[model samples]
Target: SQTIHQWPATLVQPVGSPLSLECTVEGTSNPNLYWYRQAAGRGLQLLFYSVGIGQISSEVPQNLSASRPQDRQFILSSKKLLLSDSGFYLCAWSPLGGRQPQHFGDGTRLSIL
Candidate 1:
């Protein structure tokens, strides 16, 4: 069975500070990994996606970046967080080339102060 883990379930940071969030998957290999952010009352917006190791696609250019350092580890980072950066950050995974429903870990809810 495949499972995903993401942490610091919630965070409060001052504006202009740096941010780093991590996600990892177990029981799967070379799965498609995605980072999404959901603002208050808005739909999930794709931030980045990785098809394989060292391969990432950015869906938006904002105050955020993503990286895949291992087969199952994905990271989201920001150099200087903005108040607009505060939201629900989610990590999801799907089987390679299959239509399996994407599974999400408990999201990181960030609030900028």
Candidate 2:
């Protein structure tokens, strides 16, 4: 079975500050990875997706970027934070191919001050 580890379960940052959140998967190879944000009691907003290392697709126009530096690692970064960016950020992975159920990690709650 695969496991994802996401760090900093809670974060508080001021607007215009830089941010970096990381996620790494274990016991899986070449899995599809994703990042999304969800406001409390709202639908998910996809941020980024990766099929493999160095392959990333942005799902929304925002101040954030994602990178897959290794097969099992994904990182989300922002050069500047926005007030609207406060939400629940999640890391998830699915087995290769399509239509598979994605497994999510404990998400990070970001608050922009």
Candidate 3:
């Protein structure tokens, strides 16, 4: 059985601060990882994705960046967060070849003050 974990279920930070969010998966290997953000009333927007270790694909141009250093660990980082960076961040995983639907972890609600 595969499961995903994300930390700091809720976060509050001042504008122009640094941000780091981590996600890890268990019971799977080399699964595709994705980072998505959902704004207050907007649909989900893909931030980044990884097919394997050290391989990442960015879907949007923003203050966010993603890295996959290990087989099951994905990290999202921002050196200088912006007010627009506040949103619900989600980490998801899927099987290879885009054949499986992604399973998402309970997201982190981020608020910029």
* Pairs of residues clashing in candidate 1: none
Q: Model 2, range 1-113, lDDT digits (tens) per residue?
A: 77999989999999999999999999999999999999999999999999999999999999999999999999999999999989999999999874799999899999999
Per residue, candidate 1 scores C-alpha lDDT tens digits across 20-88 of 999999999999999999998999999999999999999998989999999999999999999999999
The alpha-carbon lDDT assigned to residue 61 of candidate 3 equals: 88
lDDT of 3 by residue, 1-113 (tens): 99999987999999989999999999998899999999989899999999999999999988889999899999999998999999999999999876889999999999999
lDDT for position 44 in model 2: 93
Better of 2 and 3 by lDDT: 2
Could you give me the TM-score of model 3 versus the true structure? 0.97
Backbone clash pairs for candidate 3 read: none
lDDT of each: 0.95, 0.95, 0.94
lDDT of 1 at 86: 91
Q: Score residue 72 of candidate 3 by CA lDDT.
A: 97
Q: By lDDT, highest first, what's the ranking?
A: 2, 1, 3
